[model samples]
Target: MTDKPNESSEPTPPRTQPVVSGQAAPSPYDSPTGEIPVVKSGAGENVPRTEDELGLDPEVPGVGERTEPIANRPAEEPTEPVTPAYAFASIPPAPAAGEGGLRRRGDYRRGTLDLGLLGLRLVVGLTFLYHGLQKLAGWFHGPGLDQTRAMLEQGGWKHGELSTAMLSVAEVGGGALIVLGLATPLAAGAVLASITDAWLWKQGMAPGFQYKPVELESILVGLAATLILTGPGRLSFDRNRGWATRPMWGSVTALVLALIAAAASWIYLHGGNPFTGFFD
Candidate 1:
């Protein structure tokens, strides 16, 4: 042995630490203070390297940082779901028909409403009819056509003959139709137009002196409008017609047409503005 050393025992190579970014890597036993003591088994055999001997810091995890590996984390506890209270509630029943209750049947006051309409028609129709006859035939001590024509001319109405004719026909014919409840919407429209002219005239739109206390004309206009909207009722000739029981779109159309016609007649035939009064 002394004479010739064995090749394996000739010289052992030096162990070198791994280079990490040109710096020597620390050994597993390296610590901040120095090399850490290794734990051993009871038989004096070395135990597998613990975290303390591996040079890792023993600091606790901060907030938001994981304390354990994902595979080692405990499963979250399951929660019981809540249900809505109304889901099991009962529905309320509908109210029965009675006083202050829902009306589920036909109108019981139909007869009363029809009677009221009849009375309204009579008063309006007869009043207009009387006036119309007075102007046309000199009835009830009224001036006849010649006098009426003269009166129109004095009241700033041009085309006296045509104006007188139209006025007489609208009042007389329209009044008669309203009384009989025949073509009620047209009758109401005609009367409405005539009354509107009268209202304008009384307010001194024409050359005549302004009439004080125009309540009669105002009342007449309102009544005419009421009849137009309410229909003729079941007591008259127009009972079978739609306008008789239900004055809706057709009634509104008739009213608008009547108003247009009245405006046209006043402006064109009378040569006067309906909106302006004598003072204006």
Candidate 2:
């Protein structure tokens, strides 16, 4: 007998489907629409489809389809645009001077200078006050107003008694004000005028610069003028009471009044002609 070769009965495995990231691949043995599974035959192989199944797509064999990979899919919605948020910061302002007892601009209230100036005011003011008392009230062995008037007449004052009395009043009043550091400009003006007249009187009568006749008067004028330039010290009544005001215009006004008073005093002393020549 001739031996015929028997056929081995193993079925061929189906081809693998291509995989996408977010999508599932169709099964190899599944129908085109993936609705039904293919059945196996007695020979252990996929059952062949009928003409009706092939009618759906003549070229493709199973449920597997040619599609774009998940990496290239455009189904994802576009990301939303981001917006930034902001908040305003709050800042505080500095305190004002008047509100907290702070100094204003141009206020010169140095402690050391105030102490020195206060000492100066005391010495000058008290000395002038005493001298005024001597003339006005005959205190401290002074030539009373009557005697002072005679001395003034000898010095060529048009009205010696009136002039001497007026000088006494200014000296006494101004000296007291200076000592108290009240109305500093007014006090300085009065004292400045008085000293200016004294200097002119000495220059006119003495006629020569042999000796500095108005030495004490010049010193007094300098001190008074300095006080006008610099306000009273912190230890005075004016400062404690908030009256120690020293503005630029105040100084200017004090100087102008002093000069006018000096001119008037010179005129009263010698009939408006105190000097004989330019140098004199």
Candidate 3:
């Protein structure tokens, strides 16, 4: 017998579709679009598509759907433009005082200065108020208006009642306004004019314009001028006002007018310039 190869012992070729009489056999990698086929490793398993697979063009095989990278997709554009972080940050954040910021450096010092100014205002205002009440209503063992008028007349005031009334009004109205810090410049000016006249009156009564007799009046005049120049500070009704923050030309003008009124009162009403006596 011829030694022919046994059919059961020979290796079998891979199973494939039969070729037509004049056509080539189709390959496992060949598809209708002429692109290579994709074989997933985990067959029948729900394997998530990779970024490359997700980016494939639906119309074209083996091509990306978008020109941009998978990370920069058009579907994520709406959320990219939206910045939720700044939705509630309308105003810029400000550092608090004492936190090493230049803007808030003097906040604590300013607060202490305002408090000191408030205490000074209270003391000066209450003193003037007490004296005003004494003259107007004779409260606190003070001379009544009638007695004040007589005293002014005896002291060479031609219009004693008018002088007493003007003094009372200046003390009461100016002191009250200064205490409340309302119309601070005007109130200080009124008090300054009256106090200036009182200081001059004392100077005229003393020998050779002595300072000892009118020391108290001088201090009061200085206090009134200080208020005119410095304003009522931040603890007053005038807080945030131009005069309170920056007492400039307007306060200077008020001081000038007050001094002029004082000199005029001494010249016209008293018939003598007490200011000229200072030189002697």
Candidate 4:
């Protein structure tokens, strides 16, 4: 008999299957909708397997891990710092009585200035009116222009008649205008001219302290200058006509003009006069 074949030592033949169109073999990780199956190791092993173990993103932390819902994050809001309501309020009170007293004193000084200006105006007006009337009417021992010219001729004026007439006109006309506070600068200028003339011509011979005629006139001129510089106080027609609120620069102009006029008068009267040398 032929040697019996060793059935236990026989080699197994390879099996083959036909390929199907449009179909794939099911994967070990395949699952139905809405569920993921957990993978495990071979039998009797305790090790767990995850998608990450197969080099895939793990869904254990939940799906769409990178695309977090904005609602779950903390919100941001723009806020401004709160400030005290009275931080920018008015200035606080001064701590010293001296400051308060100084403020009050300043107010009082302003009031006094106003009152002094008013008084000066009234006195100048009355005095001018009186002298003007005396010269115009030859009243109260006032000499007529002809008599004044004769007197001035004896005192060394070359053109006595013209000088006397001009003096009378300035005195009367300027006085009336000053009293009315109309064209006050012109009036003051006229008065200044007359006073300057008296000081240079007639009064120069008189003793310094004797009943010097020009002394009163000089004072009057100074007062008139003050009025011209400051303008007629609130009681005058200048104020009523809205002409008295002159700029401060006008005072400078007035002062400059007055100084020039004064210099010119002095030069004209005394520059060539031999008599001025005697006094000098």
Instruction: Please report the candidate that would top lDDT against the real structure.
Output: 1
> TM-scores, in order shown?
0.59, 0.59, 0.63, 0.51
Q: How does each model score on lDDT? A: 0.83, 0.76, 0.80, 0.64
In model 4, the clashing pairs are none
A best-first ranking of the candidates according to their lDDT comes to 1, 3, 2, 4
TM-score for candidate 1: 0.59
lDDT of 1: 0.83
lDDT of 1 at 189: 92
Candidate 3 shows a clash count of 0
* Candidate 3 per-residue C-alpha lDDT over 27-142 given as tens digits, one digit per residue, 9 for 90 to 100: 76666667544555666554445657566545463455446555776574444565457776789778766566764455445657778778778877877888899999999999
Pairing residues by index, what is the TM-score of model 3?
0.63
RMSD of each: 19.9, 16.9, 13.7, 17.4
lDDT of 2 at 103: 47
Candidate 3: clashing pairs of residues: none
Task: Please write out the lDDT profile of model 1 over residues 233-264, one tens digit for every residue.
Answer: 98999988888887799998988988888777
Q: For residues 77-97, could you state the per-residue lDDT of candidate 4 as single tens digits? A: 888988656867798856787
Residue 25, model 2: Cα distance from true site in angstroms? 37
